[model samples]
Target: MRLCPAPGGPAPLVVINHGSPARAADRPGLRPAACDSEAVQWFAARGFAVALPLRRGYGASGGDWAEGFGRCPQADFARAGRESARDILAAIEAARRLPAVSGDRPVVVVGQSAGGWGSLALASLNPPGIAAIVNMAGGRGGWAEGAPNTNCRPDLLASAAGEYGRSARVPTLWLYTANDSFFAPAIAQALHAAYTAGGGVAEYRALPGFGEDGHRLFFGRGGSAIWGAELGPWLAARLGRPLASGAAR
Candidate 1:
C-alpha cells in the first residue's frame, strides 16, 4: 500500500486503510474503500494529515498471503500480529516524518471494516506516540457466525480497545451502523460492551446512510455524508471541541 504524508508537528496523523485488497485499477475500476474521499479532506481541514495504505495483496505492497494465514491457529491473529502491524507501524513512522506532523504529537488511527480490524489490532499494541483511535464498523472480536466471514474471533480485538478505553493511552471514537448486516448488531453491542467494560472512553454514534446493503457502506452513495456528519463532530472533540454522538440511523 502507499503512504501519502502531509507537509509538518507530527501533525496529528490519521491512518486510512482500504478494506479490500483490490488495486485501484482493478476491474472494479477503483472505488474508494475504508475511509477516503470527502472524509480525508474533512480530516485534512482539521489539520490532520491522513495516511492511507492500499493493504498488501490488492495493492503494490509485496507479501505472501497464502503462507501467512493458511488455516493455522488464529491465523488471523498471526497475520495481524506480524504483517498488519508492520504495515501500520511503517505508515506511522512515515507520517511522523512529514512537515505538518509534530514529533511530540501521536497519530490518530481511523478505519472501517477490514481496515477497522487492523486499526483495533494496531491499537492493542499501544505503540509509542499514538494520540487516539477511531473504529467505524469495526469490532472487538470475531464474527458471530464464525464461518463465511474471514475473521471470526474478532471480539478479541477489543482487548486493545478495552485497555485504551480504561486508561490514559488515548481517547476513542466508536461508530456503528445500526443495520450493519456485515457485523450482526449483537457483535456490535459486544464491541461496546467490551470497551465500556474495560473502562475506556469511547464516543459511540449511529448512521443511517448504509441503508439496506449492510457491508457495502464505503461504496454506498450516502456513506460519505453519514460518516462525515457523525465523524466530524467526534473529530472536533478529539482535535478541538466536543461533538455529538447523535443522528438516529
Candidate 2:
C-alpha cells in the first residue's frame, strides 16, 4: 500500500484502485501506484490523502487470486466484481484508521478498468463513508480474442451491471472515451442504461478519443488534465469546497 498524505491537517481519503491486466501472468508483477504517480498526486494536491492498495494475489500481497470470473462466455462478472470490492473495502477500512485521514469526512473511491468495475460493485453494497465514485472506462469481458471492441458476453455484462445498480445509491460518475478499446460507446451506453434502469444514480460522460486507445486515458500522460476538469466541479459540489488552482498538473 502507498499512502500519500496531503499537507496540513488530516484530510478526506481517496482510495484509488488499479486495474487487472489482460494477461493473468502479469498479475504477479503488478504493483501499487507510486506516491508520486499522477493519480495520487492529483488527489494530494486537492487536499485529499490517497491510498493505493494492491489487491490480494497481486504483487507483494500474493495469496490466492480470488477475482476470477471463470471463462469468457460463462464469466460470473458480478461475483468477480464483489470479490474485488471486498479488497477495496479492506483498503478503505485500513486507511480510515490512519491519523492522516479525516475520519469525519466521507471517502471517495476511484478506479480504472477492472478496478472501476470493482468500485461499482462496492457501491452496490452502499458501504458507509463512501460519498461518491469515479469509474473510468470500467467493464469486463473485453478483448475476448485479443481484439479491440470485442467483448466476451456484453449481454451478461449488462445484466450484471443492473444487478449492482439495484442497491447502489451513492452518486457516481462514469467516464468513457469514444475510442476506448475495452468498453466502446455502445457497450458503455448499454451498461449505463441497465444500471440507471435498476435505480443506480450515475452521470455518464463520453469524451472524445485520446491517443491510440482511450482505455488508457486515465493513466496516460497528460490524461489528468482532461478528466480532472470534469471531476473538479463535480467533486467540489460534493465536498462543498472549491478546489485549489493548478492541482491537475
Candidate 3:
C-alpha cells in the first residue's frame, strides 16, 4: 500500500479506499473507475492532510491479488473480510509515514463502501489514536448479502469489536443512500448498531437517489456532498477548528 499525501504543512491524515481500488498484479484488463482526490484537496485546503492508500489489487500497488490481497469473489464474503483485515493493517502502517501527519494529532479515516468497512475494522483492531472515521455506505451485519460485490465478512467487524472496539473510542460519521444496490439501507442501520455496541461514537444521514446509489459516492465528484457537508465539519471539529461553510460550490 502507498500513502498519497495531501499538500500543505503538517496536518492530521485521513485514509480512504480499500477493496476494488486495490491492485492485484495477476489480474489483467480490469481497472477501477476514476475517483476524486477531493478529500485530499478539501481537507488539505482546510489544513488537514489526506492520505489515500490503494489496497493490493486495485491500482499501482504490486501484489498477487489472490494470495497477497484477499480471496476471490467465488470464495465467499468471509474471504473478503479476511483479505480486508490484511490490507487494513498495511494501510495503517503506511499512514504513519505521511509528512503531513501530526505525530500528536489523531487521524480521521474516510472510507466508502469497502473502505468504510476497513475503517471500522481498523478501529476495532487498533487504538483510538485514529481519532475519527467517516463511512459512506459501509457494509455491516448482513455480510452474507453483498457476497457478489464485496469480499467483506460480516463477523470481522465483531471480531474487531471484541479485540479493539472497546477502549478505542472515536467520533464517527456515516453517509448512505437508501437505494444502495450493494446493500439495503438496513446495512446502515446495522452499522450504527454495531459501531455503537462496539463502544464507538457515530453520527449519520441516509439519502434517497436511485441508480446513483450503491456504496460508490464516498469519493469521486459525487462524494462531495458528504465531504463538504458532514465530513468537512467533522475534520474541522476533530482538529479543534472549523471549516468555512458556504465555500462549497
| lDDT of candidate 1 over 148-220, digit per residue (tens) | 2344455554444454345434566767766665566666666667767866556677655366745556446
Which candidate gets the maximum TM-score versus the true structure? 2
Model 2's alpha-carbon lDDT is: 0.90
Error of 2 at 179 (Å): 0.9
Model 3 per-residue lDDT tens digits across residues 1-249? 334444445656666654342332324543333223554556555555555666665556656553232333333433444466567656765667756577567767776666676665555555546777776676533334334333344445434433334534667777877766565665556657656766767776776653464455555465565446766666678768776433211
Models 1 onward score TM values of: 0.69, 0.96, 0.70
Q: Give the TM-score of candidate 3.
A: 0.70
- Give RMSD (Å) of candidate 1 vs. truth: 6.0
TM-score, model 2 to reference: 0.96
**lDDT of predicted model 3:** 0.56
Clashing pairs in 2: none
Off by over 4 Å in 2: 246-249
* Model 1 ranges off by over 4 Å: 1-11, 21-36, 66-83, 99-104, 139-168, 241-249
Off by over 4 Å in 3: 1-8, 21-36, 66-86, 140-168, 244-249
